[model samples]
Target: MSGPTGILLLDKPQGPTSHDLVGRTRRTLATRKVGHAGTLDPMATGLMILGVGSSTRLLTYLVGLDKEYTATIRLGQSTTTDDAEGEVVTEHDASGVTDAAIAAEVATLTGEIAQVPSTFSAIKVDGRRAYDRARAGEVVELKPRTVTVSAFEVIASRSSGTLLDLDVRVAVSSGTYVRALARDLGAALGVAGHLTALRRTRIGPFDISDAADPEGDLATALIPPAEIAGGLFPTATMDAEAALALAQGKRIPVAVTDAPTVAAIGPDGRLIGLISVRDGVSRVLTNFPNSEEPA
Candidate 1:
């Protein structure tokens, strides 16, 4: 039998990079086909979706899911990296800032807005990562991007001498940056703030509650790809013949609803593949068994 193949929801611990987790999982599972859904900074700890074996093909759909995070923004200082990982660029006394003012400013950033990502970010600038150029002391000018910040609100606040820290929860679209939100919030408040802490609590329907410990045995902890796929999209159960046909890369014409993608399940109870409707024809977007079957 082949090794377990599916998605692994890992509650990634701080300190280890996301790639580090992928490497560990590859070693533990003894497969080099592991891939992660989204990138999480080393300082962030939370749920991460890992695709194993044929399930790696499903990551493109998962990457664009809305995300949730709990973060702390220190309102007295700004950093080069927009987070605690970088050198402090400036400092100011935020003790005079009022709670009412903070709330008003956060409200300004709550809706759809254009935001420039941090220079210390993964976004590419002329084919080079913005972070790499920034770290090399080269100027990196990133254009503003339209991102939806559905919610950006202060949960709590604390003051320590000249500095103020606000505990916040944010719900944002796929490409939104919480660090940039902190930076912009501070800029709006005239106190120059930066992210002091960040933790991802959820990504789409998956939460930390669904994740396995980072140090646990990943192979044994795998969630069947079929199960994960079923939760992500509308499911279409096919009979043995139709399933086999789909698995063999045949387009099985079927009635379509409004779902952009459908999970096609085989009679054997495994995911045959994913399909989409184009011009009223149900076409295979991906064929799972083709990747799973021995080469």
Candidate 2:
């Protein structure tokens, strides 16, 4: 029998890199096809989606979805990495900064924005990872890219010891950099800032609550890959003949609907894979084969 193919929503704990969890998941599921939709830093935790077995095909859709995060930004100190991972390069007394000023700064960061990702980021420069080059004592200046911060709002603000801490909730495009928001906000406010804590609350249709421990039960934690695939795309139910044909790479016809992407569900209501209609013809972007585990 094939191992069940599906998405595993991993509530990644702090301290381990994303790759660490992927390795652990491979062992837990006893499969070598484990992969993640998005990469989270070791210090950050929550809502990381993993693909198992044949479900790896779903990653193409998952990676492009919007993401949401909640973070505690500590004003008055900025690090060389623009996050807690780097050394403190600048500090100031942010106690005097008022709530109104913080609100104004956040307002400026909302909507479509051009942000320079953290220097200590995963961006590839000259075909090498930016963080690698940076750690080698090379100055890496990355070009600013446009990313959408659909919503950027300060949820709460309070005094933490001698510093002002702001808790923020952000809904952004897939590649939006929350660390950059914290860094730029501090710079705009004349007080240094760095992300003290961050948790991914949502990634597309999957919530943090859906995630399970990577080291935990494989059977219970396994999310059917079809669930993740259908959740992100428009759903369509297909008859047995159509399902078999699609599984065999035959095109199916789709009726009118406003959905841009459609999930083709079989007669049993199980997802057959995702399909899109163009000029009344269905095109299969992915055909999920019955998943089985390796010996």
Candidate 3:
């Protein structure tokens, strides 16, 4: 059987890594053309957008969207990776941390602020992943980056002797780290902190509520690229002659104002491709002709 073409929203479970999901999906679909938009840590579980066949081209657009997550922050210990998976570096009594204090610290973290990602992160340092260096027992110093935390609200809190756990929901920009927020919140309260759990609720327009299991036939869950293209950018419907010309990689005289990408629709109402208007001509960014021919 041929490979499935389009996007699949996998409701990723904890334990297995994001790459594991891609490999399994590739085998299940019987195709090698598989890629995921945004990488989730092994401990995280929620919506993961996977692209099958030609839909892999859309991953770039999906990766930069804002994300939402629900997380548990343990406010009594500091971990090497700023999460439960890492070794505890420091332990302290956090029973004194109050709800008012947590809210104040969370407010400081909201909006745009400089955030230093955990050493056990995918960031490249000296041509190597920071996590690799840290894992090898090497000192890793990473610079802080400005990230936007549009929403950071604590839903609940529980105290058990010297330990305190806070449940929070956060909406942040593409590169913002929820683990880092946990770390920072704890630091501000003078009680070391780390993330206990994390579940991504949404990534831009894709939500965990609409996700399917990876163990199932992912081909059946495929969402055509045309279905998503209309939501991402402006659409330009063209005639048969124009669509054919674009399919052949020819530029046509069309005006797409103030938009970097335009969804080109064929006369048959199917997506022709993604295009950019330059010098009064529409140039193809990604082509999707009416034929089901494989690339």
Candidate 4:
């Protein structure tokens, strides 16, 4: 509860669960109030947004941001988990799967579409994780949900024997699973398919290129609350009295339009909270304690 409060853009290495990085961040920063906006599988590596201290309140806003990933989809073999980490469940000769046909199918997968998440995913069923039930040998049935795939472009292709591997870059909305895309792509092309590699490149305004390795200096890597909020939402500068009124849970008069939420900055240029405007009146949606003060 008492430490540097801000966001930490971490480049998570493969083989560690997202939770593992969170734990490591806690140890490095010496704070237990760390939380992440999204998660990646142990076999995946990518940018992970971590909120430290009071910045944990910001995670809720960051979770729904669109994400981008670069991955390899291996055609000719399907796996139980829809990724290379799972056992092979089916195999096919993908050599006959033409590039034009793959491109056509990829086009169909773009835009808004209904998709079923992989059974070995983190989705919860009956208060238990779907993956847990799947590993226990129980059938896990997940419903299809609408998810937008803004872009699904094949960067390169490699063929070996009867297998074809496609390197792809995908931009998708939050909650869209890349593994499922690979699985569905293969199924649509009449061949078995699964993700062989995945690395998230971007999430909203945050990019992997700006992310820091968790093993390095985490304290210095903390991004202040004001900077984090400014990057995500339009900002409204408030005077001392207005900042106090909003902090006291009272509505303040501020003109905001177009955006559903705006970051409220206090007279000192520190983020005070988030506010939403309705008919020119701003109401507090979230309030942050003055980061300069002790917890």
Candidate 5:
């Protein structure tokens, strides 16, 4: 049945990469129009929003939203990848690490700070992935970037030999890396560290409960296009004249009440186009479905 299209929230499993999940969803839905909002590491299991059909247009708004994750950081050994999948390069006594120390480090990590992503990250360097360079024994020195760690709380801690396992929950802005947080936190305390577990709990307004099972029907899990458009801003119904003009990508003199982004709906409540307030005039950022049929 043809209808309004949008994104599906899936609770991605641990074994498959984000791209693998997209491939599986495409095969299941029998459509090549599927794409993901963001990439999740293979070791991470949690909410992944998959865009389908014309709904892929929504990613520009969705991907920039903040995300929340729960993770376990192991302080004692440094890893090549800064995660459990990497080989341990060094180990030391972590018994000296106290919960209070970890708390202080968390405080330091919170708020706006500079972060260096793991070398085994998807960040591109010289037209090659950082991880590829790292695996090839190449030293990848990446510049630190600004990322806001809104919250960084240590929930639990345990000590085993030289290992100090810390469970933490963090809410951060887009591009913030928990793996990097673990690495930096350990170094801040003069101990090497690596991430052992990670699970994303939320992405903006979307949460784990809103996600479907990894093997569930992703096509059916998609939120109705109207709901997707509705989440951005107050809706504005377009007349036949405005609709036709928008379908042609032509600018109109109509005023948008929203401050930043505004969704324009047609007479039937069908999402036609996305318009933004530029200075004072409403300019088109993008149009979903067909510019002719809906936009």
Candidate 6:
């Protein structure tokens, strides 16, 4: 809590679990108070949002943001993990699968649909992870959840003897799994499918192009919490008295309607906290500890 506080957009390399990235970030920034907004499989590379120091409080707001990914879906073999890392369970001659058919199935997968996650996912079940249960040779039956897939476009395609590979870009809501989409698409086409590669390109407004390499200069890569809040929510300027009242757990007479939460900026231009307006009054939803500290 005493170190630099800000958000870090990290472009994670493959082969490291999301938790591993956090550990490396903690070491790179020399702060143990690092946290991430979302998780990525060890086999997948992409943009990972990390919050350092007091900015860890901002991760909850970022968790629900939409995500964008570019991936390769193999259309011939289905795997235990719904990815290349998993053992192959089934194979088929995908050479006969037509591009028109692939397009049609992809169209169906787009928009809102119910999808079952892969058995090797990190979803918790009865106080244990589904992947943990799966690794123990137990059958994991995850319930289907509704998720939105705004876009699922096949950017390129390659067909080899008995297999077909598709390079695609997908934009989806939070909690939507790209592996599930690959599995469902393969199943719909009569050939089992699994993700061969995946790279997250964006999360909400944050792009992978702006992300920093965790092994590089991470201390200077931190984005101030105030700047992050300004980009994420509606802004409202609060006078000294109002800022003090909110800090003291008192509701202030600030009316806001543009958003459910407003980024409250103090008179000195420092971020006070996030506040919610209701019935013509605003109350602090989250208060920063050192609001008066100079940026």
Q: TM-score for each prediction?
A: 0.96, 0.94, 0.95, 0.96, 0.93, 0.96
Superior by TM-score: candidate 2 or candidate 6: 6
Write down the worst ten-residue block by lDDT for model 4: 286-295
Per-residue lDDT tens digits for candidate 1, residues 224-294, read 77888999998888888888888787876666573579998877678888998665557888988633632
Arrange candidates, best lDDT first. 4, 6, 3, 1, 2, 5
| Candidate 5 ranges beyond 4 A from true positions | 1-4, 278-281, 290-295
| Candidate 6 minimal-lDDT segment of 10 residues | 286-295
* lDDT for 9 (candidate 1): 91
Worst 10 residues of 2 by lDDT: 286-295
Tens digit of per-residue lDDT, candidate 4, span 1-295: 3477888999999999999999999988778889999999999999999998888999999999999999999999999999999999999999999989999999999999999999999999999999999999999999999999999999999999999999999999999999999999999999979999999999999999999988998888888888989988999999999999998989868866735899999899888999888888888899998844222
Q: Which stretches of candidate 6 lie over 4 Å from their true place?
A: 291-295
TM-score, model 2 to reference: 0.94
**Clash count for each candidate, listed in order shown:** 0, 6, 0, 0, 0, 0
Taking the tens digit of each residue's C-alpha lDDT, what string does model 5 give over 39-120? 8899999999988878888888899899999999999989999999999998888889887888888899999999999999
Each candidate's lDDT (Cα)?
0.88, 0.85, 0.89, 0.93, 0.84, 0.90
As a whole number from 0 to 100, the lDDT of residue 25 in candidate 5 is 80
Highest lDDT model number: 4
| lDDT, model 4 | 0.93
TM-score quality measure for candidate 4? 0.96
Collision pairs in model 4:
none
TM-score of candidate 5 relative to the true fold: 0.93
Instruction: Flag regions of model 2 displaced more than 4 Å.
Output: 160-162, 256-260, 291-295
Which pairs clash in the backbone of model 1? none
Query: Over the full model, what C-alpha lDDT does candidate 3 score relative to the true structure?
Result: 0.89
For candidate 1, the per-residue lDDT at 240 reads 84
Error of 1 at 43 (Å): 1.0
